[model samples]
Target: MLTEELLTLAAAAGAAVATAAGTDAWEGLRTRLGGWLGRGDARGGEGALAELDAGAAELLADGTPTRAELERYGAAWRDRVITTLERLDGPEREEAAAELHRLVEREPAAREVRGGDQHVQGGIRVHAEQGSLAAALINGGVSFSPPPPPVRPEG
Candidate 1:
C-alpha cells in the first residue's frame, strides 16, 4: 500500500514533467516513470523504491525537509502513482483526475520552480491531490450516521 505522500509526490512530479516538457530534469524524471510504465510493475523496483521510500519517510517523520533532493525524489514517484490511479473507475477516477489537474495547474512545468530548471515545453501529467485521513475514512466503505439521541419526552 503506497502512502498518500508518495502518491502526492508522484502527482507533483507528473506536473513538473508536464509543464517543463523537454528539460533535462523532465526528461530524466519522465524516463524513470517511463521505466515503471514500460515495466508495468512498480513492484520490480522494490529495492530502490524501498530505499527511497525509507529516506522520504524519514524526512517526513523529522518534519524538516525543504530541499532539492525532496523535489527530485517526489518527481521520481509519479510513475507508480499515475499508474495506480489509472486502475480506478467512476467517482474515484474522476476525483483522481481532478486532483491531477489541480496539481498540474499549481506546479505547471512551464513556470520556474525552485528545483527543476526552466527548459522543457510539454510532458504527460496526471495531477492528483494526496488523499487525506478524512478521504480514507469516507472511502472506507463504512456507513455512519449520527446515532439517534435519547428519546425525547412526548410534548
Candidate 2:
C-alpha cells in the first residue's frame, strides 16, 4: 500500500509532467520520468517515453490548452503515476517518490503561483493567474475575513 506522502508526491509529479509538456523542460523531464518509470528496463523506458510523448502531443494539439484540458491530463497522469508506485517494492517506491518530488520541485509551474491576492473563504481559496480570471460563487451566507497583518522584524 502507498503511503499518503507518496500518493501526494505522485500527484505532484503528474501535475509537473502536465505542466512541463510542450515547454523547454519537457525533454529533460520526459527523459528523467521515462528512466524513473523504466527502472533499468530499456523496453519499459521506451514505452514510457512513447506514452509521455503522446500525451504531450495531445495536450499541444490545440496550440494552447485550456484549464480544463490541463486538469484532465493531470488527472490521467496522476492515475498512471499512482499505478506505477503501487506496483513497485518498498525501497524502489521510496526512491521513485523522492525522484518525483525533486522533479516536481524543479518544475516552474509546480513550484509557484504568480498572480493577484488569494482569498480564502470556508476553507476554499481562489487563485487567479496572469492573463486569467477566476471567480467562485458560494451559496448561503458568505463572510469576508481580512488578511493577517504582515510580521515585522524587530531591530
Candidate 3:
C-alpha cells in the first residue's frame, strides 16, 4: 500500500502534467514523465511519450479549454499515476516516488512569470481588466488615481 504522502505526490504529479501541457514546461515534463513511466525500457518510453502527446493534443484541441476540462484531464492523469505506483514492488515504488517528488518540485507553479530583462526587487501585483493594461516597474513604490468616469453624450 502506498503511503498518504506518496499518494498526494502522485496527485500533484498528475496536476502538474496536466497544467504543464501546451506550456513552455511541457517538453521537459513530458520527457521526464515518459522516462519515469518507462522504467528504463526504450520501447516503453516511446509508448509513454506517445500517450503523453495524445493527452496533450486532446487537452489543447479546443485552443482555450475550460477549467472543468483541465480538471478532468488532471484527474485522469492522477489516476494513471496512482495505478502505476500501485503496480511497483517496495523498493522500486520508493525510488519511483522519490523521482516523482523531484519532478513535482521542479515543475513551475501556475501563472509563474519569467523573463530575462525583468527584475522584481520587491513585491508587486498588477491587475488589468476590461480592455485595460497594467504594468509596473517598481524600485521603491508607486500609486495610481482612478480614471474619470466614462463620458456621456450631450443631451
What is the C-alpha lDDT profile of model 2 across 1-155, one tens digit per residue? 78877766666777778888888899998998898888789999999999999998989998999989998887788788889989989898878877777767777665442122333434776799997998986655676779789999999
Runs in model 1 deviating more than 4 A are: 1-75, 108-155
Better of 1 and 2 by TM-score: 2
Model 3 lDDT per residue over 60-82, tens place: 99897788988898788778888
Best by TM-score: 2
**TM-score pick, better of 1 and 3:** 3
Backbone collisions counted per model: 12, 0, 0
Candidates in order have lDDT scores of 0.49, 0.79, 0.79
lDDT of 1 at 80: 49
- Candidate 2 weakest lDDT stretch, 10 residues: 112-121
| Candidate 1 local lDDT, residue 52 | 43
Better of 1 and 3 by lDDT: 3
Worst 10 residues of 1 by lDDT: 132-141
